[model samples]
Target: MRKCLSALLAALAFIPGCAPEGTGDLDVQWTVGLTGSCAQANLGFVAARLETLSGTLLARRDAPCDAHAVRFRDLPVGSYRVRLSAFDGDGVEAYAATVSDLSVQEGIEAASCLARLTPRPGTISLSWYFQGGRLCSAYGVEDVLLSLFSADIEILAQSFRCDRGAAVLEGLLPGSYEVRLDAVDAWGVPSHSFAAGNLLLRPGHELSFDAELTPCQGPCW
Candidate 1:
């Protein structure tokens, strides 16, 4: 019993945020370098820092003296930070920061722009970070019930767990619907909810929505 309980606790630690194998990879590696003239500049060198939106620092390295590169790898799919800096004899720090949205694909050598994630027809997918901050999955979240309502706030379908974070809400009357998501987090705690969009669910086609979550607050109401 003790061994079983320990195993259960280990699994719980990896809930919602960590998806199982075969889901996909979110690893990316790229180089950052300095351009233009470095000599005329106040400092002879620059530095770089890669971080997540949650303020997690992924990697950091010194900027190349010339047109050089810094490589970053194994980043999760989502948002991140890129900071640049230079130093002088005074030891006073100077830096710049930028945000980057990254998507990882297996065997792809280069990064694509964020505009590419738009959903297409036939296999509508809706994804979000669940209770424990893990990706919602087919095996785990496929069992929760769903109820879609129209833009008029009228009920459409009653409720059923749409497998694989992608639902084919078939037999529709052809109109827009307000999408709401309710689920449990990685820890099996009831999820905080969200709306996909004021979406136009067209007939005979698939619609995809990436419904991410935000911290619950009275202001959200």
Candidate 2:
């Protein structure tokens, strides 16, 4: 009886780390370049799981330009397929782009950034290929939340369930500001932080920052 109880306790002790088996650290970053020019556009990064694709949505929520690039980090260990879309400045639906055979392993940085250009402004959209590293029936996260703030720590805008993997902050007063992304886990723990340094933007022109959130707990974990 003592040995049986010991074994049972041991299994329970490992369940938190082993059960569900979907917990891990993931970080991503990206940048976009204007057409026909070397000038680059920046997109923020995010920390998410393979299941966060369900609520992935895109809107022509910014300005002109079409070319964009994205990067993923600390993803789960599995394969993935990425889907993309193009939108005009008016938020009109366009076409789709797909990438297959993408894989993510533990402890390795996955170069999941998608970079492509189209002639329309509102034609850009995004989605992922993996089912949260699990072949189970359900999909993971629907949409990740993004909060944009100025240097003064003022909230410019809060985008919820933003599918585009990018936000076009237009109508700004044209100045320098700081950007950060917030990442949450299944237990509602905010562990990652992605920040962009002094970004300069013009009133009419748009600026994008791909804030990639990674798994970063405090020293104690």
Candidate 3:
């Protein structure tokens, strides 16, 4: 069965082209496979865009999730970039991936141009340190609570028990956020709080910061 299928595919790849003789036919055929968590999410649809290196749009397609793949056929042999975006039921972009510098050659099908989509989200890596004072003496900071707030100070996401003086907050949408860090003592009492404002996060990027919590004479909130 495998040998027969392989022979059939080889024969189909040589369909005659409109181009005159001596010019030869180097038509490109490509396929994008959906893998990883994005595939497991069972998104409603997957969209793709093909563009030239100079940013000129070449082609676009939208395929149903059940198709399990997207195929582009009869393309001119050239260098191009293909970007894939997967959308959920609510039409929100859930995952994205890009395959660039694709060089389509004669008699060679670009069937392995697989785009492994990852969840469309940003991450925050923070390193926290405690400065000296009476607050440090009275309390042994055991864990840290990191909170992400919107422009209006509404809580968007929070991470707890961020230990080892370092933590990573993942799966955040692209936007501006305000971060609040609170130190929790061994007794579970909040000791000090620090605020970092106006952090911009974008997809496929990691935002990092180093926070130093100083001793406060009065309440830090």
lDDT of 2 by residue, 45-160 (tens): 21122332233332112223322434444444444445444343334332234444443445434444453432222211112222233111133333444555667676654544
lDDT of 3 at 39: 42
Off by over 4 Å in 2: 1-143, 157-159, 162-164, 219-221
What is the lDDT, from 0 to 100, of the residue 221 in candidate 1? Answer: 31
Worst 10 residues of 3 by lDDT: 20-29
Q: Cα deviation of 154 in candidate 3 (Å)?
A: 3.8
TM per candidate comes to 0.33, 0.32, 0.46
Candidate 1 Cα outliers beyond 4 Å, as residue runs: 1-35, 112-221
lDDT of each: 0.46, 0.39, 0.64
In model 3, which regions exceed 4 Å deviation? Answer: 1-71, 74-119, 132-139, 156-159
> lDDT of candidate 1 vs native?
0.46
- Candidate 3, residue 214: Cα displacement in angstroms equals 1.5
Residue-level lDDT of model 1, residues 1-221, one tens digit each, is 53454345345446885532221233222222242334433344446566664567877777543433454554433344555554433443322334354433234464432111111222234565554555446324433334567655747433434335445555454456777665544544433457665677532345666665544554433
Q: Say which candidate scores most in lDDT.
A: 3
